[model samples]
Target chain A: MQDPFVRIEGVSKLFGAFQAVRDVNLTVGKGEIFALLGGSGCGKTTLLRMLAGFEEPSAGRIFLDGQDMTGVPPWERPVHMMFQSYALFPHMSVEKNVAYGLKHERMTKAEREERVRAMLDLVQLTQFAHRKPHQISGGQRQRVALARALARQPKLLLLDEPLAALDKKLREQTQFELMSIQERTGVTFIVVTHDQEEAMTLADRIAVMDKGQVRQSGTPTDIYEYPNSRFVAGFIGSITSFDGRVTAVEGEVSRVDVPGLGTEIVARSVAGAASGQAVTVALRPEKVTLTRDRLEGPNAIAGEIKDIAYFGKDSLYRVTLPSGQLIAVHGVNAKRAEAGRPDWHDKVWLSFDPAAAILLTE
Target chain B: MRRRPIFLISVLCFGFAFFYIPILSMIVYSFNGSRLATVWGGFSTKWYVSLFSNRQVGAALLLSLKIALISATMATILGTMAGIALARFRRFKGRLFFSGMVTAPLIMPDVITGISSLMLFILMAEWIGWPATRGFTTITLAHITFSMVYVTTIVQSRLISAERDIEEAAMDLGSKPWQVLWDITLPVIFPAILSGWLLAFTISLDEVVITSFTTGPGNTTLPLLIWSKVKLGVTPDINALATIIVLVVGIGVVIAGWLMNRAEKQRDRDARLAYRANE
Candidate 1:
């Protein structure tokens, strides 16, 4: 957000007795695909609606391109949204639907038609321009919606669960198409989605939210590897957390005694974090390496594999420790379904380096 | 015939008989050549010829059409506005009272509404000196008042089920409020408005009690003429007139039914096509 194109300062929204969004401060850099990631009713959509001028913030101001967006109606704002339902006009053909927003602009009819043709071409939907929305496939309808929103060429674009309506394969293809379109248009995008994988794959940066508050905001890898809170780690990815207390603090590493695991854990510590303070030690599923033999590592625990789920390229093993706490370990199938892979009821050793375990004090 | 129960067949026969018997009897009697409505001397076209030649009946029919058309149009416009207000603005002062009063006409007795309107017209004439005599203008005003209630209720329910996000989408795409209504909302609800207008037109054309209470001497609508003719005696010409009215109404209902069915079929086909296109 060094050269911010859109800034939301201390924005909060309240619906009667329920506070939909807490005090939120965020800035999106120009031409960046920023995502607001959360569960249902976590205020991600409300924040997006506020940015599109559909909903007014109850207590704070929003600035777009250094101009205050206070009291500006949605029709006047230089922002547009691709709705979750698409909301394509049922009475209009695809060509007309894409040209709808241009009716208000001061342009000649020929120029408007040219712009619409270009937008349809950009989304690779020029062949289906004259078809009605329902006459096309779900994937084609989605492209029509994208084409319509981009036809306006607004300064900022908001997308609400753009791929939620499509099948899995179509959604994956649409994600890449959306990214390339954003790259070509150079329009700032703020997407709101409850699907964490979609956010990870499509976002340049993501803000993970919980209960009306932002827990963490960073690049996909940064948030995945170093989540700052227990909620962030659990929400963004699958993690097994244990209650522990800091026993000793080294310069950059700390040893914590966890009663749940019947062992002590070594994790990278926060600067100036004192010993004897209670904290939660979190380990991601894929971060823990599972093997048949015990490793000479700082963090290794023995567990019995209670369940095995094969997902073609990889497998998920639910391991039950001696203390009855189950830990999930994602094992990559390096060898093609060989006997060396761990199976149910097999005893295994799960090990991770000290840098892999995230230490959360809150 | 394929394993159909005898009891189900009897019920179906009973239902159709109950709906169609009265209309069938009326159409049959219209062909009666005798002056007595109950006695059929022979089939003849004399009654139809006399009915078409009557100047009084022709004038009344024309006046009725004019009143129905004007009232139905005015009612639809006002009703659409009221419906949108009630459906969109959730929190307004006196909303409960406003909605309750709007629907009161639907359930109120025609005698009560007619009499009450009569009194109001008299009072207005005394005070404002407008509507100097009650006739076409007074009758149309009264029809619009009651007919708009039906329009409002129909429009309100149709609008409630309409996708609200479409309007917000229009606004987000830089449409003004009026532009959004014209370009998006109204088109989505056009069929509802059309049905409402037709209902209003039918109610106005069929109403007699209200017209009687409000009409002056010269303005004789078709229903008023028929009522006066029936008082003298049920004439063969009146039977011919009634048969024509029933045929027109039956045709209208058939067309409307076909239109609604076709629209529903189109929607189903579109849904199927969308899925097929996916593969």
Candidate 2:
């Protein structure tokens, strides 16, 4: 079997007494766009820096393409990083900036020029080649930084918050551009971002981090659908959780008694779950359906609409159960008319499939 | 409605008149037909010709220029290194003391600086038997000592304001530390270094107090020459020399100011353009 393009083995970092990253082990396949998703100070950036060789791991080792990366300086590492601020060389023109890294490649002059031309064309900034960084737009400067980083055709590229500086409209547009560029370059990418939507939209796989440790690592859909812990569920998206105790265990399902809803919810059986074990049933808001008609079976709960928030395509309803617990339910406005839509203080029924509810042990 | 502050305008006018009248009169007097400075006999170029013929003042002017150029260049190199150290290295042994000492010369009185420099030179000459006599070498050293402080302040502030990530990005792009310094850091701070050099040159050119204590025979700068002549009472020749000095220094200052202003405007324009383009 071929080895992973990049492998991080039990990496850890400490700043003085503060542990910034703890025992992180990850692997990235070739030409894959992987995201390190977390909030500020969650060791996402620390790991990226370690990959770029800016920070050495306090423990463990890193290997790139079957070679040990220990004791390698950043300049000697076969990696490049697009800094968060797009740190373009302000003194150099866009063309010169793109060519700056190529100076060390030992290429012929004409070959170097051709590489720079190709890079600028790749980022679609050929028109701004002669202009200095400050003379260009922020988005244009970001492209210049990308061009410069990719000029050398690094084995791995690390991007630190590439779209965080862009405005909303520009961010959406740039997201597609970034994906297309990655597709064309075929370079393995490790992007660190705090925006969950960005990670969901951009990455093939994501590692959700908290504090100084990895909470979960999987494909975006896998992480959203089946989070192993409460933190992962909360960090990925909005979820309404209920306190429950396992009442009975059947062949492939477990019956959970939730006092909050005064109902027994049938869910997929969790590993190591006992008959009386306490657990949380986390259900995404969008997974539950809201209607005025009564729902039968263990998958349904009756509630009254306490509040409604209209959000164009979808509306979020806060439903208060008979037990006085408030639960959120999301309904898509698929129909044009509001004739049968539930409003505030109206009776409603929330129903979900047994597979839609996630059982979290933590 | 807002008031224009008429009283403030009058105060500003008074300050300008007080400062400019003497220099203006001297300039006007340099073209005097007669030797007397108080009464300007119709404009003539006689004193200007005599001033050029005076070998003493000519030699002094050349010496001052040479000293200023050499010292300012050396000071800029040394001071820029010091600035980089202070700005980039957050912690080193005696960092606080080093920064304090670098800036102390800027605030220290010229008299004290001159005396201290003179004493050090004398002690070095006696102990090491180097720099046998205090002449051009001593004066140039003294000028560099003080001029470097100004350069350090300017370069340090520039480095502080510059983003560190630019250099880091260069390193990540496969350039070594020395390559980043040469290709990235130096170019970014070149404008500040230039202005610092000009300032140091101006300060060294007209310096009197420090030069007075440090100089020995045959090291008379332009200001020192002008001072002795002034004590003997002002002459049309001296007036011509002062006017010439003022004109040269004025031109230098105007050019330096223009360069600084242009650099500032270019930076501002780039920032504004980048911001507008971002949309």
Candidate 3:
């Protein structure tokens, strides 16, 4: 019922002959952590820049808190951006960098210092207030950049690849820290990242982008469980797909007949495909179960394990069905699995519940 | 390897002697008791005292310092502005032409600059009737016209080497263009400006051919005085004055080298720190 914190309608950006962003429309609710996830040159950063007013939309309007911000410059808008390079002024101390925007508001010296102190404390960089950017570590610099962006108490914060500069372990740790900070501030945080795992861990809702367009927008769970398009299904997570034809539609489920496997599989289709329509059935590797003996399930296929990869926590088995379609099955490292391990060239049956498989229309 | 080092050391020593022997001999002759430069009767300080007491030499020295200071300062200011404009604003038309014009003075012969500047000033005076005579003002104007090219080339290279991200970051933090220039641009280029100013000052101070053509009776610089004194035959007083000039130049060179070395060390330290932080 409440107005969305930020609303984008028909936004498009062009750079010479290349169309960077094509008619992107989305809305972020107040206190929501939204992510724009895509690969390189997918226009995720361009969309975020347009939202922050650094880049203007060639065709569309943006509304922030019921006010239009299409023509507003970055300095005038009630928004702040954390650059991909974390463009901290190298000459200034941490305190001066954080207090920079406050000084523009003509705030008193006391008021500016107070806000700066509070922001540094919020980011836990109060002790490094006098340190220059080069004196701090990358993680500390990241916190300093965050403190500087939040010092103005912006209604919206745009982060461009917030953790891309960090190492793998540090990046993973910082993702949670960033989420906690977003929760504490309760500001609308819109993060742009090419890392899907980071988006899954940080965003409440995600818009998967490809070729300057939003392929699908949904919660992480919804996107992972039910992807509307093939791009979204392949991009968000690993998926094993098979081309099939819809046989019948009953209630909310559709029965699909797939070749090579010689099985009738039922899958849930949100797009409402008609009978006899060609469709693709996508299943996550972890959702399918692999066993030496035949297993009872709604959808089942018999195949031979072609390759086995032993991960510490689990084992991944690549199975080739009689129809020559390769499918992957992930088995957890449980007590029973330790006693009996499936080897390569072993006859295996892969089975999953019908609800676990999704029917992708595109 | 040791033999090679010895050979290189001997070559370097020979080079140093070849450059300094003539200047050192002149300085030794400055303290000579005899008026003839080749014959030294005994070491004495009479020539030094007499050189200071000479009215023409004192007046010429003062004129040279005044012209150097004024011309160098004006050239540095104009060149710095031009450098920042060219380096920061890349969209302007004829940018290449502007840059070429700035460097044209550096390669142009001193004779050409002197002749052209004299003609320009003369024509302007005849048309505008502002500068009534060819004196200190005219000489200073001429020195600045050529010295500005050197300053612009140095400052422009420094500006190009500086990171644009710093300026953009300042702007993103709500500072206007002028504020960015004042707080960020100026500070980053301060060392370059100082070095350029020193270079201009040195060039203007030592200039002979251009100053000789432009100077009038009342605007004779120190080099012009030395020239006229030499034409009258070598005098111990002139030698003493030349020795003093050489000492002043040596000290200036040492100080400038020290300042530049310190700046380079600071830049290296900052770069190392930035690299570590990124890691």
lDDT of 2 by residue, A1-362 (tens): 16888899999999999999999998899999999999999999999999999889999899998899999999999899999999998889999999998998989999999999999999999988999887888889889989999999999999999999989999999999999999999999999999999999999999999988999999999999989999999999999888889999896889999885767999988797779999999999999989888676568898999999999898999999888888888899988755678888998888988888998878
lDDT of 3 by residue, A111-157 (tens): 88899999999888898899888777888889888998888888999
Candidate 3: stretches off by over 4 Å = A243-251, A255-266, A270-272, A275-278, A323-326, A336-338, B1-47, B227-246, B256-279
Where in model 1 is the C-alpha error above 4 Å? A336-339, B1-4
lDDT of each: 0.91, 0.91, 0.87
Per-residue accuracy of model 1 over B1-279 as CA lDDT, tens digit each: 755688788999999999889778878888888989888889988888998889999999999999999999999999999999889886899999999998988899999999999999999999999789999999999999999999999999999999988899899999998999999999999999999999999999988999999999899999999999999998888888999999999899999899999989998898898788688
Model 2 bad stretches (over 4 Å): B1-4, B29-45, B259-279
Candidate 1 residue A65 Cα shift, in angstroms, is: 1.2
Q: Which model is ahead, 1 or 3, in terms of TM-score? A: 1
Error of model 1, residue A25, in angstroms? 1.0
Q: By TM-score, who's the top model here? A: 1
lDDT by residue (tens digit), candidate 1, A140-186: 88888888888889999999999999999988989999999999999
Give the Å shift of residue B139 in candidate 3. 3.1
Model 1 residue B221 distance off true place after TM-score fit, in angstroms: 0.9
Cα-lDDT of candidate 1:
0.91
DockQ measured for candidate 1: 0.79
